[model samples]
Each structure stands twice: as C-alpha cells, then as structure tokens.
Target chain A: MKKVEAVLIDLSGTLHIENTATPNAVEALKRLRASRVKIKFVTNTTKESKTVLYQRLKKLGFDISQEEIFTSLSAANDLIKKDQLKPMLIVDDAALEDFSDVSKFDGKPDSVVVGLAPEKFNRPVLNEALRLLLSGGKLVAIHQGRYYKTSSGLSLGPGPFVKLLEYAAGVEAVTVGKPNVEFFKAALEDLGVADPTTAFMIGDDVRDDIDGAQRLGLKGCLVQTGKYRSGDETKISPPPDLVLGDFSNAVDQILSHIGQS
Target chain B: MLVRVLSISIGSTLLRGTCNHISSFTVKRLKSQASNMDGVKGLLIDISGVLKDGDVVIDGSVAAIKKLQSANFPFRLVTNETLKPRKTILSTLSMLGYNIDEKILFSPVPATVEILKRENLRPHLLVHPRMIPEFEGVDFNDPNCVVMADAYEHFTFENMNACFRKLMAMENPVFISLGIGKYYMDDDGMALDVGGFAKCLEYATGVSPRVVGKPSRDYFLAAVNDMNLKCDQVVMIGDDVLHDVGGAQAAGLKGALVRTGKFTKRDENHPTVKPDLIVNNLAHAVELLFGTSPS
Candidate 1:
C-alpha cells in the first residue's frame, strides 16, 4: 500500500538455483529497475566470495553489478576489519579471497570466524577452533541458518557448527548475517534509506529473509522458491506480508502496488 | 529416628504462636503423624565433598563411614563424578582409607546406560576416554542419541561437532547429560564441568538433554529406589546446596548441607533453597543421625 522506494532482492533460491536463474527473474528485475526504484541484492550465501557470486549471476543473464550485492561474507568481512581482529577463518577456499586483507591464523587467534565449509568441518580443525574459544577467543558466525536449498536437496548450514563451538567454550558467538537485525540495518544504512518502511525485502526464507525484514519495519515478500517447504507460511506469526509463487510474481505485485505495472 | 522426633517437637512448638494463621491442632496432628510414621531409613552421600576433596580424604569421614557400616545402616554414595568409572572411584576411596563397596556406589554412568537400554536408543558418547569401558556391550554405531559427561580434556571442538551433527540428523534427537553442574573442584582448582558442554550441544541441536545425575528428579528417585526406601525415608548429604540439597528436597527427600569441600557461606544463606539440615561435616551429620559421636 505504501510507496516502495527501495527493494532488497534475495539471490540463490529466489533469483537462481546455483547455475540457473529462476523463470522470468532476469526480465522482472530489469522491469523493476526501469521503474527507477533503488535496488540492492541481499544474500546469506556464505559458500563463495561476492565476486564469484556476481560472476555467477551475470552468467545467468541477470544485469547486476558487484556494488549492488550485499552478502553475509561482506558483512563478516566488515566486522573483522572493524574489530581489527586476527581471525582463524573456518570458511571455504572459494570464500577466502574476500578476507585477503585480514591477518592470517598463526595457531594463536583472537577470533574464530565460521561459515559453510563442508571440507573443514572435521575433528582436527574443529578441535583447534574449540581450543581457541576455551582460551578466550571470540566466535563470529557469518550466518546461523539451519539448512539451505541445493541442487540435490537441503544441506546442513553453519548454524549447528557455530553452536558447537559456542557450547563447548561457554561463549556466545556474534552472528553477522540474516536474520540478525544488525545485518538488515547495515544494508539499509549502505543504501542511505533512513526510513525502513519504504523498502521491501523479497526472498524465499520465511524466517531469515521475511521475518528479519519485518522486524526492522520493512515489508516482507516471501517467494515460494529456494528452501521453501509447504506449510512454511504457518511457521511465523503475523505471516509474511506477501507470499507469491516466485521472485517474478513478487516483482509484479510490488510494481502494481507502486503503479509501475 | 530421634532426629525426626526432635524436628517434630521443634516444628509444633514454632507453629504454636501461629494458631490464628494456621489450625494449630491440625499442624500438631500432622507433625505427630509424620514423626511417628516416617524416619530416615537410607542415606545418599556425596563423595567428592563429603568424603574426600579431590583425592584428599576429609577428616573423620572414614571413621564416620565405618560407624555407619557397623550400625547396619543402608546408604549409597551418589556421585556426579563421570570422569571415572565406578571401579576407579571405589579404588580411589579404598586408597584413601575409606573402605567403600562398589555395589553401594551410584554414579550417572550406570544410570545412563540403563536409560539408553530402556529407551532402545544407541548413544554417541561425549564422555571421558577412561569412562568408555563402563559402556561396554552397548551399540555405538549409527547412534540415535548423545550421552555427554565430563570429558575434561576430551571436550574438543571436533567431538562436540560430531555429536552436534548426529543429533541434527536425527528426526527425534535424544541428548542425555550425566550432570549439569557449572563447575567443580579438581586437582588444579575450579574447572569447567559437563553442564557447559551439555548446554553447548543443547543450544546447537535445539534438544533439551535428559539429565541423569544430581538435581534430576529421576536420578534422585532412582538412587532412593535402589536403596529399597521411600523418598521421605531418605536423606541426602552434600556440600553443594543447589544440586544436592535442593535437588533432593525437590524429590521428596530430606537434604543435609555439610560445611566442607566446596561449601561456602553463600550456600548456607541460599536465596531459594533452605537445606533441611546443616552440619559441620559428614561426621557431624552421622552423629546427628545416630545420636552419638563416631568412635
């Protein structure tokens, strides 16, 4: 009902699934941009760097630039730089390019940064992380998602692993990604959007994307794609403001509300 | 028995002035009935604080235990010590000149094993390395549950993560913790206990663990039932007020707080829990129960 000045788009399940973009997503995004509404791509995909993700989106024919994407990896990197921390990164090799400026792990670390690194989730690496935590090192989780949609099926996220270190060391980790309110606020701060109500977040996750945006007074549009299961609408109270078939439908609804359709 | 009569007389006398607030006759009758019917029949003794403080035997504890044995009283050493097996605990007590029988010792390890068998659940153990022998013959492959104890040095990230993954994979996860104590006195001094590690797994998996040790109602009742005694007919003696005294009182058993080992003045004036009895030491509690000094 309110005039939508800015829009936050979710990648992965909402726009594309790995290599392929969702049906009509590229064209819908182009149409929305023509409406002159400010757009920012907010994602919790911690598996790869922002450059790689941008490259993938470009390959999928989405007319997106690197500056428009705000990822959990970017948030974590900002936090690491702000804190001036010497961190021990437990992230994927592909994601390491983003943290090139930070100091490397030298057995003794001041913080332990965690993301989705399937290969590094073994005992020896985890034990080292545990010891660091026990010795009073901080834990920074990129995101606390339980699971995410993949080509095969749903796979485990870094949330459980983050909790493992937190529990064993008797410390609480600082999560830097959705549905953490600070993450959403940070993206809006970057866009210089002071009034959160003027923006809408379009994503597939009921909790992280939809509920997270709503908590900050932004309208949430949950698309039934990427990690969405049937009956997901009933999971959250005061359910998603808009539940549509996919990202394209979500765009259509937003455009029509703003008289851009 | 004498202690019960003494408590009744004191209680009735204290309630005499509060007749307007409560029915005095009913109070007297209830106290009389309780004193006449129920008396302490068995004792649940804490080992670490009451008997020995980290391998050093408390003064007069051995003699007090001997006195209890000679008097033919039924008692069990209820301990949350999961770092060692029952055999190791027995040997440690024996070496300290406190002759304790293995049959009367009650630790969470054996109780947890029973729970696993009863529930038909296989466990992925996150306990100490030395304590694994106690879980012999139990299936450990493709575990449906997680059993955590004081793994001490074994509380590594890898082990905790493995247990976390196992619990996450299960449709219905089962997590069992031996004890949930925050910290305990070890040789080095106060060290982190199993509860922190258990809390870690619980937080990660969103599974509330079934505690099989001190403070759990089932654990206290199990120890009482093992002595073939009713809940009201037993007393628990320990240094920790919240776990031992508070837990036992909550389970319908009388609790005695001993001023030894980890006991502090704060526990004496605990905000919530009022210990049923307070004594100087295990020897003092035994003297109060038997109405005589240990010979």
Candidate 2:
C-alpha cells in the first residue's frame, strides 16, 4: 500500500516467464516491499487486457492489482486524448481496455491509428485504408518493427501493416509507443522520477527497451531471459549499457547502482 | 488492318478518360498470325450511342449484327448497361429489331457482384431509388456494410450514418456503381454519381471504396465471357477511358472509346494507354470488323 522512492521490476521476461510469473518473483517483491521501493511492472504486450495481464501475473504468484500493470494497449485512451484526435480508425482488437468509451467513426476516420488488429485485414479494411490515404487521410503507425517474438513463436506485430500504409500513402506517421520518446517520457514522468541519470530501464527487447532507454540517457539493461534470440542483440541501433541474464539480476544491480540496495 | 475499338470515335479513336481530345498513338503490331487468317478476331461494339435511341433500337445496327454473323466471325457486345440483365437486354434488343441473342450483351452489375463475392464484403448500394423494385429479391441482410443505389438526397450523411449502428467495429463496405459520372433525370442537369457518396464515406472513415463497375476487370470479363469466348478474343467498347478502355485493358482485353461519351478524341494518345483502332462511329466499326479488319 505504500508508494516507495523507486520501483524496480520487469513485466514479462523477468517477473514472469512467457505469461506466467517467475519463481520467487513474489518474494523478490516482498523484499522490495521491505525496502519500500515502488515495484512497477510495465509491458508492451498490447494484445491482452489489463485484467487478463494481472491475472497472468497473479497466477504466477505475484499479488498485483490492475492499476500496477502498464501495457501499451492501456495507453490508447491517453494517446487519443494527447493527439486531440477523434473520428479515429483503430487497427486494433475490437475490444480494448481504455478504448471502451471512444466513439467509432461513422464510416471513415479522420486519422488511422494502427496498433494491433490481427483479425480484420480483409479487402474492405485494407482498401478502405488505401482509399483514404489516396484521398489524403492521415495515419499514425505505432512502430515499424515487423515481427516480435513470444514464448510460443514469432508473431506478426502491428509494424508490418503500419509500414504498408506508409508506403501506400507516401507519408510518414507520428509514432506513439516504445522506441519512441513519448512513451518513455510519459512512463518516467508518471513514476515521478526527476533525474534520468539515476534511472534504469529493464526490458527484454533490445531495440525497444534498451535502445529506447539509451536514446533517452537512461541506463538500459537487456534481459537475456525473455525475447532474446540469436543475432537479435546485433540489431539494436545503439547497444545497451548492460546485458543481464534476468530481471532479478538487473533490478538487484539497479537498486545497488542507485545506492538504494 | 481493321481493328475496332469501343468508345473511340471513328475519326480519331482514343481512350475515353480525363484527356478527352484528339491525339495519336504509335501502334505496335504483334507477329502477323494472318498466314491462315483462320484465327479468332475480336470485335468491340457499344450499345447506347451506337445502337439505340433510348429504348428504341436502330434497324441498321441489327443488320450489322447479321452481317458480322454471316462473315463466320464472332463479335462481343461491350456496353455499360447497368439497368438490366443480359437476357432482358437481348430480348429488348430483339423486340426492337436487333438480331442479337443473350450471348452478345454484358452487364457489369451481376458480374461485379460475383467478383466481389470472393472478397466477402458487405456492400452499400447507391443505385437509383426507383430501381429498388427490381432488387426486391436482393439480400440486404448479408454483409450490409454499405449500399447506395440512385440517391436523390436520400443517400445523405445522416441516412448513411445510421448504418454506423451495425457496422461499428467493422470497416465500411465498398460502394459499387455502374459508373461514376454526372447523372441526369427529367430536367435536373447534374447530380453526383454514386462515386461522390462513396467519397464522403472515404473521407469520414479514412476508408475509400472499391469500385466494382465499369473499369472493374470482373465486370469486363463477365461481359466478354457471356459470349463464351477466350478473353483474348473479346474487345471492349465504351465512351469512357477509365470505364471502357482502361477497364478492358485491365481485364486483358483491348478497348476503344467513342468521341461521343464524356471523353473526346484527344484521349487516344494518353501516354499510359491507347486503343487498338479508332473509327468514326459504330457503323464504320462494323465495316472494319466484318470486312478486312486486321487483328
């Protein structure tokens, strides 16, 4: 119940394996609780709802609430507000947590925000997008990465269609997620952390979590336990400062590095 | 070498499109298979300006059909008649004294619907409102994305927006029309075609529509295929380049534009597309296709 000076946690690879909680993650949280370090879990898994994500973590032994979970899909409401955009076309799951109340465009949208819609790629959708873009409709693609891996297999993320629209329109889109500074800025600001020099970012993806932190002048750690594949480390635009085996190792080092361990 | 192209006028046959002027094109001839001259020869003919006076058929046009039949050569009717079916059109033509059967006429509607069925879209119609009587048998309950037939202020944003109730969380369906041109009724000079309403939906949803009529290959081939001939053996005739000539080319058939329709003679030299042959009118086209026309 007590908010702490710092939150040291990982969402996917470290605190949980695949979609389940890692062993001792709850105990590690108890230790962080004793130290009064705020334990925040952030993830980019935009596919699942917050409740489902929290349930997965709970099933893995972490006693967490929905409020402590931060997934990219959760930011839809804030993002739509921040952009001051309405009449938006969503290339995402028909149902989303924060997107429950937004109005669907009558027929076409003022802008297209392609996040992650895996099911609705028929000619109507694609060609309608093409038609709008051809007729000068604006688009906002999340990130340009084509594919991302999970515990099971590689999946087609939102990046492929995002880039597809870009090619068709010959116009670029404003990004709104990981690897983009907006997400980092908002997350750090929400954490009430004033100094970036003392901050550390722990994530499994090298390009998004690590390079994204590095670009913002934060200590970036790549966790080898989750989402790390052979030759993927080589693809990071800027290498991370540290590459640890897991979240436990990264958080331990981070707490000690900031003189709070 | 006599090659008849649809829509392209006889004086200077050109593709009907944005460029409606008299221009020229460099003709590239394929290897002359004329040794036996026994191969197939495709002929393109128009129905409205060339054959009819609005529900009245020209007797000479019927004679033209017989003459082409007498030559042991087959001809294809490539028209943009969206209001009726092939059999009905043929029967009407027969009653009006044209010597043609159902094998010659092509209507873009049913063929476009079939081609679009493969896409499994819920279409919105924008045809004439009076035409709905003919569609009493049509199923509006299936894939009810968007449908507009002859809209007379009835296809307004308010009425169309009501569809947002069921179509929410789903992309808008395509608006298929026979053609995209300024339509007229009685004395009203100009009204936006279905394409205009389709554009409004596109602007509102960031989704444009898929046009299934005119230049659509599905419709072109369906028209040509009704004749039971190879696609290469059919020719397309129309008054618009985008609707007639370009549609034919996209369907792998040759196309021509008559100077009579929305486009003029200058459409012939469009850099990207050109018709195979140009003629003064359908009568001259008949003479060229039935006599010593070169393929």
Candidate 3:
C-alpha cells in the first residue's frame, strides 16, 4: 500500500447503479472527502448532459462538485474543442447541452459524434451519419461500451450503433472516454498528479476501470457492484490489486491501504 | 434441376426415392452455398407492407405469389398482424386473387395459443376485436399473462392500467407481445403497433415481454421448421429492417429487403438490419431467388 495522491472513482456501478445510490456510498464518499483525498468522479454515461448528471448526483446526496464530475460527454467536448472540429452530434436530446458550443447544421460536417440516443437511432438519422462518414467525416464515439444496465435489464447502448456506423462507413471511430488512456490521464492530470502510480482507480467494470487504469501505472480496485458479474476478476489479466464488496468496502480498503503505505 | 425434385417426390415410388436422394444432395449444396448464398430453397414472406398496404393489395403482388407457387419454392407468409384471426385473413387473401393455404400462413395467433398451453398461463388479452376469436379456448378468468397486440380502441388507458395492476400483482407473470413493431402502415398512414406500449410496460415492471411474432427467433424458427428447411435455406422478404430483415438474419435465415412499404434507401445501409439482398419489390426478390424471368 502507498499514499494515494488522487483517486478516480467510477460513478455508474461503483457509486450508484442508475439513480439510486449504492448502499453506504454517500457516507463512504463523505469520509473520503473528509480524509482530504483528491477525488474525481468519472463515468462513461453519455446519456445525459453534465449539468443534469451533476444535479442528479446532488439530489442523490453525494455532495460532489460539478468540477469534480468527469463524464464522457465532457471528454468528447474537450476532444471536439482540441481538434477545432464542427461535428454532427447524435446524442440524447438532454445531452445536447454538452455540445452547445460546437457548430451544428444541416449538409456536411467534419465529424459525427454519437452517444446513447435511443429515439435518434432510427434509419434516416443513422443514414445521415453514414453519408457524412462516407464523404470523409470523422466518426467520434463518446464511449463504445456495448450494453448498459437498466433497472429493467440490460439495454443496448450506443456502442452497437457506433459500431454500425463504423461498419457501414468503413471507418474506425475515435473513442474519447473510459478505457481510453487519454480520458483517464486527463482526470489525473486535472488533479495535478504527474505520476499515476500515486493514484488509485476504483470501479465495478474490470476492463474499463480496473484493467485500463492498471495499464497506466495506477493501482486499480474492483468493486463487486453495478454491472459486476461473477468471474469478472478471472476475465482480466494481472488481476486487480484488490477486490472488495461494494463502494463502502472499497473506501475502507483504500483508507487502510494508504495508511499501510 | 433442384425444383423438379420437389414434384418428383410425389410421383412414382422409384422416382420418389431417387428424388429424395437428389434433393438431399441439392439441399446439402444449398447448405454449403448458404454460407455465401447465391440462391435460397424457401421464402418466409411478409404480408402487410410487402404484399398489401392496409386493406388494398399492392399491384403485382398476386402475380408474384402465383409465380412463386409455379416455381415450386416452399414458401410461407410470416406476418406479425395479430389484429385478425386465420379465417378472416385467409378470406381477405383469397378475395385479393392470391391462392394461399391456412397452413402456410404462420401468424402469431396459433403461436400465442401454443405458448398459453405450454406455459400453462391464462390470457389477459389486450388485442383487436378481430383477434378475440383467436384466443377462444384460452382461460381468461385467472389471468397470469398480459397479452398485448395492436388493439387500437381496445388499448385504452383503463384497460392498460388494469393489465398493469394484474402484471404487478402476479409473481413472475408473463408479458406477451404479438409483435414488437414500432408502427405499421394502415390505409390512413403510420399507426402505432405494440412495441412502444410493450416498452412502456417493460419500463414500468422491469421485465421484458416474450415476443411471439415477426422478429422473435422462435417465431421465425417455427415457420422455417414447418417448411422442413434449415434457417439458411429460407430467405425472408419484407420491408421493415428491424423486424423483417434483421429478425430473419438474426434467426440464421437470410433476409432480402424489398423497397416497397416503409422501406427507404437508408434501410439498405443500416448495419444492424443490412439485408443479404436488396430488391425493388417482392417480384424482384423472387426473380433473384429463382434466377428466372417472371411469366
């Protein structure tokens, strides 16, 4: 165990599973903040705008600041800005707020930004995206995670449609979120952590949160909640540094591990 | 050469034996060719948009079906139209001057009946008035399943709320949707199908319904199995990409898209519903299958 400089916590499964926060997560987050640990909340949720997401987290009693929340939509916004790209955004109507700065119009565009907009995934809309790509427009995916857990069951996420555009347009989408090194690195960089080895990445998803962070020299902890299936630890190579029960347990482990170091 | 074997099987016993052997070889060749299918043995045709839009049969539909019959291709109409019973549907087809059989028409009614019996479930039918006769013998007194279809006027707020209560109260109650079609073309325009409401119930109850029509793999398999052909051997011809083309292909059956009803140029490029073949109409799909000029 080492003194963790900053922590990148996964939001969806780790802190909250769709709206309702995980048991004891609010208390755990309060303790982490009290401990003066530099914490940033990261998510691959491209469904809603950051403002709405922030409001939701605030209502759910997480006490997270809007600046501390790092969403894929925000990451995609940064990528769009950095590249100085005019993009056709195909995200949820509520999520359109995140891309208001970007120029959006009919006819041709430089890139096609896609996210989870179930109603917008029809034939005409997708075809428009395809035609743009065929004409050499860039395909930018917010996050290419396959399916997301809903209260009902697993529903198709933006990944399938993103892949569809990729297959049809014969172009590889530039993914700008989770499991992408740049997204994780950007979060840590914001916290003024030059060395990722001093940071810990905690999440329920083994590949995106744990394994991805581990590759970038960060200590990764797998929390068995939110989309965590049985035998997930076995699915990853060079297993996570620690596997804990839930977000509450994970917080306890993080504190003890930091003390030992 | 393969077409003759179908007729020869019913001729002389000696010829039947020879035809059986030849047909098996041809079917085996078809199975191999199925990997990169240049031809198909049978068809699972869609009725509504492909054949007729609303009450009126599309022009050349009768001729195309007759040509398919003469060509000796084992075909069946796999439709999601659960609004009407079998007798009414058959009468309508016959009136339209197309010769069709009750056995070859695989709609969702019989499948619904079979499911009710197999699962030992009772029906709480939220369907069309015409569809009421289809669930004749099913017990409705002790409702254990919420059967949803295009009930139109019957799909009122009061009925849906009642069904919702029944679904919520029962332990592991089944939600049966005849077809999860987003909408269908009526004489007026596009009208809502059961899909949106099915999704509503799913969102409310947090349980996905068992779809027993069109896109469901089991439903497609039933029609494919009835023809005694492998999924690869049959080609589904329809207009809708999600239900008709994607459904069939997902069920291991090849799919051909017809740009007739609800079909736009974009459907050809939709990666999820990318049909194996795209044609102008049902006639063109049939011609592509048989490699012959329409008589």
Leading candidate by TM-score? 1
lDDT comparing candidate 3 with the true structure = 0.78
**Per-residue lDDT tens digits of candidate 3, residues A1-261?**
557899899988788878899999999999888778899988888888788888888999998889998888988998899998889888998998888887565655888998888677654566567667777899999987655567764455676667656655568889988888888899998898889998999998888888888999899899998877778898789999889999999899888867777
Question: For candidate 2, lDDT tens digit of each residue in B33-130?
Answer: 12212333666676775566567654346666777788766666756555555667777777777777554555555555555555665554555454
TM-score (all chains, Cα) for each model? 0.76, 0.48, 0.56
Winning candidate number (DockQ): 1
Which residue runs of candidate 2 sit more than 4 Å off their true CA positions?
A: A1-10, A22-24, A29-39, A82-84, A87-95, A104-108, A122-124, A142-145, A259-261, B1-295
Misplaced by over 4 Å in model 1 are: A12-37, A46-48, A55-63, A76-143, A146-175, A192-195, A223-231, A244-261, B1-38, B119-125, B128-133, B136-144, B150-172, B182-193
**Native contacts kept, each candidate:** 0.11, 0.00, 0.00
Sort all candidates by TM-score, best to worst: 1, 3, 2
The TM-score of candidate 1 is: 0.76
> Considering just chain B, what TM-score does every model have?
0.80, 0.67, 0.76
Report the candidate with higher DockQ, 2 versus 3: 3
For model 3 the local lDDT of residue A80 reads: 93
Question: In candidate 2 chain B, what residue range of length 10 has the lowest lDDT sum?
Answer: B26-35
Candidate 3 lDDT, tens digit per residue, B126-241? 88877787787888888988998877756554455556667766788899988876554455444556675676566545568899997899889888888889888889989889
